[model samples]
Target: MFKPLWVRSLFIAFTALFLAAPLMAEDVNLSERAPSFWKAEGQDNTVWLFGSVHVLTEDHYPLADKVEEAFEQSAYLVVETDVVNVDPQAQQQLMINAGMLRDGQTLEDVLGEARWERARSLAADNGYDLEQMAMLRPWLIALVLSVTELERMGYTAAHGVETYFLERAEREQKSIVELETLQFQISLFSDMDRDTEVAFLMQTLEEIQDLEAQMEMLVAAWESGELDKLEETMLADFADYPEVYERVVTRRNHNWMNDLTRFLDEGQQDYFVAVGALHMVGEEGVINLLREAGYRVERQ
Candidate 1:
């Protein structure tokens, strides 16, 4: 279970981080400390790319000066999605609409006997009731359980990096754009293959007890800004779950590359593009794609 924990860590780091959290920040160094920041220069424009952790803690801010500088220099801020203006209640209803099962199917029916019992047992151990999760689709159940585990391990969506910046953008009246939509992000899970979704849920359950240790390593690796270590611990682990990797990371990276290049070529203003750190690393990442397209992308 823990053997593939790093792969799951990357999954959580990339997608779950984008899920909105409460806006919160605490005093921290003002020095340059963003995990990975890059400047992609086009013939007529520039876009600063910063790899963002979706959820973090109060202690992870005040971000590095360079990140702030880039934001100041840019005319627009881009995120995977703009969660800042979404209504929480509307979002909840949207989730309920997408996360429930049809034909009176239950989570147990979806997970089957062994995996259902495994999940129920884990729930009991963590003081949760699987009965409460009965109507959730498997992917939703996985997200619910994983988020609970992450919370137990001292992580909160409210402390995520994206929430922090979105608040700033609103306060400053800076333009904010999205690479995708909230509906599109939600569909990523809602549309997952049944077996792969179950495997993901099972993998998440198996890693519940180890999440703290895994995230500790993950945070450290992220903070160090070492692309190789980040790639190894995050992206490389996904090799075992090829379909999950392709759908969640690879495909999105490719799509975002097109959006990124277009922004460089067509946008009238410099932009600050923030996405999950995972999308900025490895061979298929946006960074490499831009570099291959002949843009001068350098770490800032």
Candidate 2:
């Protein structure tokens, strides 16, 4: 599931948002090249769509001038889910309600003996007590493992792309819009098929062994603004899992198309739409979907 550097990069960052605190941004020279930026030109107002890495290391800032310029010009900041504004207690409750198994079901029951032992060993190696996570669903456990592994490598949600933009937006008093509720995002994990969830957890555990290399490749691709490379690295790993890919990536993109179209149709206020970088790539992504609707979506 996390084969691509960016998808894995953001997924872990997304999980860490609940536990991490905001931090001040570092001062640095503007990057020569940053992640991809697109413009969805409308009859009147325009929407600037930027691909966001949910979690990042300190080195990811300061963003390229184009990103800052887009933020400066737009009236609103729209994201998949506005983590920065949500209450910590409410967010935690949302996760618990969606990610915990009911009745007598334990994580060990979901993972089985052999896989459960492997999970325990992995957690132990990383200095975590797996027993504390026995009540969490496999999807939640996968997130725990990912967040722990990413933290060990120095990535933090405090430095994520959305957090960066969100902080600046707050200082500037920009209006924020959420495409989906926090509960909606949590349900993506809660609704997973049991077998698929276990396989997803196992795959994440396998990928942890190569976390360093994966991070390197992903960070480089993101900073270089290589959209093709990003799509390949992110989507190739999930080709075999059509159901997961469809649900996690394709379906969400489909669902967002209408809301995105309304932004264009309204043409009343300009928008700076920042979402996970994964949503901007591939054929079924918002970029092509908008193009298919007869709007010019250009890389800016």
Candidate 3:
């Protein structure tokens, strides 16, 4: 269902945004603007890149005037994936196919004794029951717990950047495009090797405890465009897990580069691209990737 697949997917996107360090002039006056948005100039067409916070408080809008203007000027809206308007049956099938454990294997078997105990303790402390949650892969359980914690805090994907723009796009009858499919996004977690998945799950469990504070920090960083803390969070969080960082952040940017550049180079109309902010961060981020490919990607 959209409930399960996009709940996890939305959490993943928000988590990824925590890793983004925007490329903008340092110490810009927040009163003037924020730097989480950009514009790429190609020979013919233009692409407006807005780094999205996947979850936000309802008062977080109306967005900045520049972002609104960019959307108004564009002919198409592009997002990482369409979590809305999905087939519930197909999404549930994908979840079942990718998230379930095989015969004779258990969560404890995969996580080993100490990690399993840590997982169980954390889940129980957070009001989850491991026995009832058994048989799913560790990564899926991690995401499930993360989504639950977020919901408990009253955040919903209905207030997310993608959803906001998506609803407006629909109302305006503007075309919408997806950079990836729901299945591919799921495989980013599900296709990881066992150890990688366990490590990811463990880190997620440890981090969710301070989620509220971390979330406020995320919003503060977004508004101020000061990224020292987020850069630190990004490195400390993913530097040890190069594979996880690659799959979740860098590699996906590279994959999206193909679609992004095509839109820039050959599209019949201009586009507005809204992606997780983290995919636009770091040296290997999509904004830099576009610049390296010879487009002049400027902060908006």
Candidate 4:
């Protein structure tokens, strides 16, 4: 039914860590450690920006009451993607397409022996075989690897903020707009080099041991809404993998910023914009960039 039990478990653990720490100092600034919700009140429009952790557990969510209220008050819900109403078959197809590698390539050829062996060990620990994941794209592999590790630790997408909002939007008939398409998101991964992909996978495997502790600190900071700490920790970790960081984080932030401006200008409706928390921090973050663009962004 699920990808695998271990994969599911890893997502659960990962989500739990994110929810447990609402705020922490190790990876974020104390002031920014608060919730990533902001409101830009204007004479004609009110925009609420929410920093969101994509995946979580049911027990950790609904967010705060204020968050729910914000949603209720908003005229529209804007998400990174409109996964809420995506066709089941289309979504599955996207995942399957994202997982496939180019015809000639194999995981072993790309990862080499030591790394491949480590991947095999990781697979075994998670109750699967490395070969099973061989044809998966590097980016998809990275996502799967991350989700699997978190699942082993106990995080689940079932409880993720995005998933929750998606459910709510469906029930309430709220209008939902996608900031980007799944195809665009998937293309980011397809653009990466084979070596970079292999390196990312290997690095992720190596980090598995410290994943819990690191995630704990990150989660605490995130829950507390400490943007600075979260930014610092995430950036430091990102520096270790520039390829993945550039593709997944940096580029996407830029793209989202462009969409935000267009959305604000055209929609003319109150919106609750929920995106990954990480995208809302750092110099290149949406919040900071929005401020630079002359929009007054205040924490709510």
Candidate 5:
């Protein structure tokens, strides 16, 4: 049997929360982005890799002192995307164009009756109609549902780590670079099959009730700088969605690894690269990849 949508939603929620907690506090004595930063001998630049959560609440405040210090010392700030200057209207247009299915491809046609009804009922509770969302792909629906739930829970992208740092970078007159484009990220969702999309949504919805507990554990692990624990949780949650893992984590990690090396070799300028925390964990994580490439990675 496939997992419920709520369960999958909870996993996504927990994952987002886990990545965001590191940016909430401003304690100078504590380390925030660990196993995320790497130092290279005989190189004039320092590379600070930070894992970020995409949404956050007011309760998650005062980013860790180390993160702030890293930002202050760095000359450039790198993010997954340059959302700071992105046009909202254009973004919405992109999402709608990418998420909605072609004419005649309805959710019912893809999801069938039993699951479709459940999905409809869940959407109704959130002020959306099933029929209206029927043309949207499953991954798109998953994103909409996840964002809606986080918003209801008082988390917003406006308060997220990436946005916060982007804002800071702009104010400090620091140059900002993106590892990927929003369109590229959106394309990842477009490539998912209907079944995987439905399964992802169903699993997310089933985990809604346990989001708080999961968040607590994720935050604790991240704060403790336990990369292995973080990697384990991600691997388990993402096992059902290999495509997502490949698109969002693995492939991107490799791309960034190449970019990091190039940046060090060519510019010799210090860069603060902040990406989703999940990318920095696991065997193929950017940390290990960098280490394998002969760069020294440290937890501080």
Candidate 6:
């Protein structure tokens, strides 16, 4: 099953949209480009929404003053999930339990001979051991292949937007919160039907060959807050794959709305909410959802 560059791009896009960032750049000039940050006013407090890159180069750092100020003022930092606090061992165990194939099945049995061979070749080219990787399901394989390629490109989660704030939140002892758990996030991929998972893996393999260039386009759109370019590059083509978009972006955004809006209504404290940049744009995005719900949301 073939997919477009944008569809394949989602495999990489999810890196930023979900797990983490983009193609590691040698230099990222943030002086002129507006940060993907916005503000929503509440009756007593405010909510700051910063579109985050899950993994990024060290050069992306020294966040914009607007973003920094929001964090400084807010009492709580909210992310999709608090991955930093998850125990490493437990994290590994969860992946194992969730991704492992059934006892009687092998990856070849699932992906079929030709497709399995293609996956094996892709894995080796990406420096993953096919034999060990063969034990997992398609979604898990796709996840591993994508992340490993990003790491090879020098983009890493340690330098991600959430990781940066998460560490500081721990040091300064600021309150940290999660919109979802790691388990729930993982389940999003794991629960896909078998055919969809196969297509996902296959397109992902095709996508990563030119992953760096594709991500550069995505990161540029994200960095400059060019909503049109972002929508075109990241979302427009999803008209053909609405189910994936609904599953990966829409439903999750709606689910997060309850928690996101509560910060405003509770009047307890301001929140600096950061999720993947994709969640902040489009008609169904969290920002618009906030606007539709009658809050004053402005780009910062």
The Cα error of candidate 3 at residue 10, in Å, is 6.1
- The whole-model lDDT of each prediction reads 0.74, 0.75, 0.72, 0.64, 0.67, 0.75
Off by over 4 Å in 1: 1-13, 17-30
lDDT of 5 by residue, 181-230 (tens): 88886776666676677776766555545555565565555545675776
RMSD of 4: 5.9
Model 2 residue-pair collision total: 0
**What are the per-residue Cα lDDT tens digits for candidate 6 across 193-286?**
8988888778777667776776666666666667678766677646667887788788989999898788988867888887887787789989
Each candidate's clash count: 5, 0, 0, 44, 29, 5
> Residue 6 CA error for candidate 6 (Å)?
13
* Per-residue lDDT of 134 in model 3: 78
Error of 3 at 126 (Å): 1.7
Off by over 4 Å in 5: 1-42, 124-128
Model 6 residue 159 CA deviation (Å) reads: 0.7
Preferred candidate (TM-score higher): 1 or 5: 1
lDDT of 1 by residue, 98-127 (tens): 989999999888888987898889878867
Report lDDT (Cα) of residue 219, candidate 6: 69
Instruction: Show the lowest summed lDDT stretch of 10 residues, model 3.
Output: 1-10
Write down the TM-score for model 1: 0.90
Task: State the RMSD for candidate 3.
Answer: 5.3
Candidate 5 residue 296 Cα shift, in angstroms, is: 1.0
Model 6's number of clashes is: 5
TM-scores for every predicted model: 0.90, 0.90, 0.87, 0.82, 0.85, 0.90
Error of 1 at 2 (Å): 9.4
In model 2, what lDDT does residue 95 have? 79
Higher-ranked by lDDT: 4 or 5: 5
* Per-residue error (Å), model 1, residue 54: 0.2
